[model samples]
Target: MTVWDRPEPPARPVPLDRERIVAAAIALADEGGLEAVSLRKVAARLNAGPMRLYGYISAKQELFDLMTDEVYAEILPEERPCEWREALRVLAHRTRRAALRHEWLADLLGGRPSLGPNGLAVTEAKLAALHGLADIDTVLRAVETVSSYATGAIRREIASRRAERATGLSERDWQRASGAHVTRMLATGRFPALASAVHDGADVDAETTFATGLEWVLDAVAARLTRPPA
Candidate 1:
């Protein structure tokens, strides 16, 4: 065929790269949870053959790692706080917010080591926040403690949200009226403390509950810290 009759080489397939591949995978996961993401589906979204993705990612786990790191980028603050307490608090809150935005994140938050650039940057920020306050071991422990709390809390919050959506009721309402059996059990004198808390406790929103618990943990960390002399 003549040059004029050629099909223009199909536009170079839009220049596939790791970023585009990860973005497509993340979008798929966001829409349908982590189960929805696969190399074939990601390839289909990018209009490329499945084998073409192998150049950028060897397996699905690597794709997940990339997606997690990308979310970490979102978790990183534009301006981190200088004080250790506020800085740790910001990391926890921002991470929770990011998980809320990407519900699938709850599944993978602490599932694996985050060795990507953005993920390492987040770790660095947390460590830097407590740099001079204590020894390296103490600082590492503090960071781990805060991170563990944030991860567990985020997962629980997301699970609660999903339960709420599934049951068409708020968590408080669900707890209050789970069933006749639960009501009867609560009424029994055998579990007075549990019953009292169920009946008398304030039904706070999820944010309030998470914040209160986080502050309590931070307070515990503060108690353990060996603050340098002023």
Candidate 2:
């Protein structure tokens, strides 16, 4: 056919799937935090019309679920730790690491039931580690409690890091600036306990702090396991 008579080649559309949609959302989140992600933006990133994403995910919430599950896949270690304490400890640390990698995770951590397959698998691993080691009630409580600590701790860590990045100062430096005002408050002598803590507390490593707190929580759980019933 002559060049003028030739039909234009069919336009190639970007492939659309849940994984690609979720990846686009994650890239947006990683670049600008969770608040930056949107269905329209994600669709644009994949070079598809916004309505195209509705086929894979119905709402923004579903997209959040997918993002969370992606993080869960990263949190689950290939080699499961054998002992219950070690397994739980490793699970908590891995989760914290995942939050570090994907700061948006801290916002959604334990905020809702993780119904995704990988999320369910993560829950199963935690329960399996404690199965037969404790009563069902204790096992459930143990899993929930450990998750609570990890989630709360991770949120705090991410907040601190974001603040550090914004201000270009570690928490200690931020505190020192606040300490100036605190020192003035101390002179008023109305806040003795706050004064003592502020003056006496040492700023320690975050990893060490998180590890120590997890061990303390685990120790408490162990006590419950061994304690005699009334």
Candidate 3:
């Protein structure tokens, strides 16, 4: 066909990249949940075919990894603390806050090794905070311990929040009033320590509980450190 008669090439498809793919996946997860995210759904969100996504992510798990790393960017501190303890504490809190914001993160936090750029940056920050405090082994152990606590805490917090939403009751109310079975069990005195804790323990908010537990973990780490934080 002559140049003038030739059909114009179809408009170029909107640019696609890892960022866009991950963003679409994250949006899907946020609206529904991780289970809601799929390559077809993400591709649909981007006005592309599912096969097109293969160029950016080979599998669903890879998409999840990208989403997790993207969230890690939010966990990176704006200004890292100078003190190692404060640095670790900040990282833990920021990670918790990030998980809270992206509730699906509870499902994926520490699920896999984070090798993405942003993820590595987070690890580097944590390691840098304890650069000279001890031998490499000890530092690695401290980081892993603190990270494990934070991951477990965040997951529990998310699970509790989900339970609260499902029951339309706060945790304490759910435990104390939602079930007569619990009350009967508590009164049986078979579990004296449990009963006492349930009846007499001060009811603290989730943030306070998390912070207190984190401090305890930090204290334990401090005890093991070869050099104390300045």
Candidate 4:
């Protein structure tokens, strides 16, 4: 076939862009966690030279930032709720869902400022939820508090799941956390609170635990907003 008759190499795969690069990286992260994602791997996934991605993403952190912004898209509700409480609740739950979908997200959540468009939008929605309901400082604190809780909760949940998978035992097992070490610690009777928690505490669902903690944090915020200014 002549040069003109050839397929033009399928238009060079539509020229890699930031969106495509982030997508490829996210796919790799989804399969094997953040540690598995690298510029070389993403380039291979896209069938392009590794240098090609550099034109769009200067560094690996930028790629991770982009991936995080993409996740913020999931955190924004389709139709925002009217009440501030509901709005905050929706945002928290959505963030948790996003983490579950991309478990590696737990590593980056709240790790750095998200300056991308989507990340800015998520922050806007969070602050807007209480636009006129409270003072700016209070609102900022509330949003930060919720975000911190979500970040920690998701990280802990992922760690728990990983530990469970590494060991054959379910989280309900008596020795899930440290196996024989924890069992032995409990046996010593040196720490009553720790022993009681390990023995008497009911096994609660992760989602329930997260929601319960979030509600408590929100309650504190609510009190701050409603109370007369000191």
Give all TM-scores, in the order shown. Answer: 0.89, 0.90, 0.90, 0.88
Per-residue CA lDDT of model 3 for 65-133, tens digit only, reads 779889999999889999999999999999999988889999988776787778889999999999988
TM-score of 1: 0.89
- Arrange candidates by TM-score, highest first: which order? 2, 3, 1, 4
* Candidate number with the higher TM-score (1 or 2): 2
Report, for every candidate in turn, its global Cα lDDT versus the true structure. 0.86, 0.86, 0.87, 0.84
In candidate 2, stretches whose alpha carbon ends up further than 4 angstroms from where it belongs are 1-13
Candidate 3 clashes: the total is 0
The 10 consecutive residues of candidate 2 with the worst lDDT sum are 1-10
Over the stretch 1-230, how does candidate 4's per-residue lDDT look in tens digits?
22112232223554876668889999999999999999999999988999877666667887888898888898888899989999999999988999899989988887677887788888999999999987899899989998898889999998888777787678768355567897887788898898888789987899999999999989988988899978
Local lDDT at 135 for model 4:
84
Residue-pair clashes per candidate: 0, 0, 0, 0
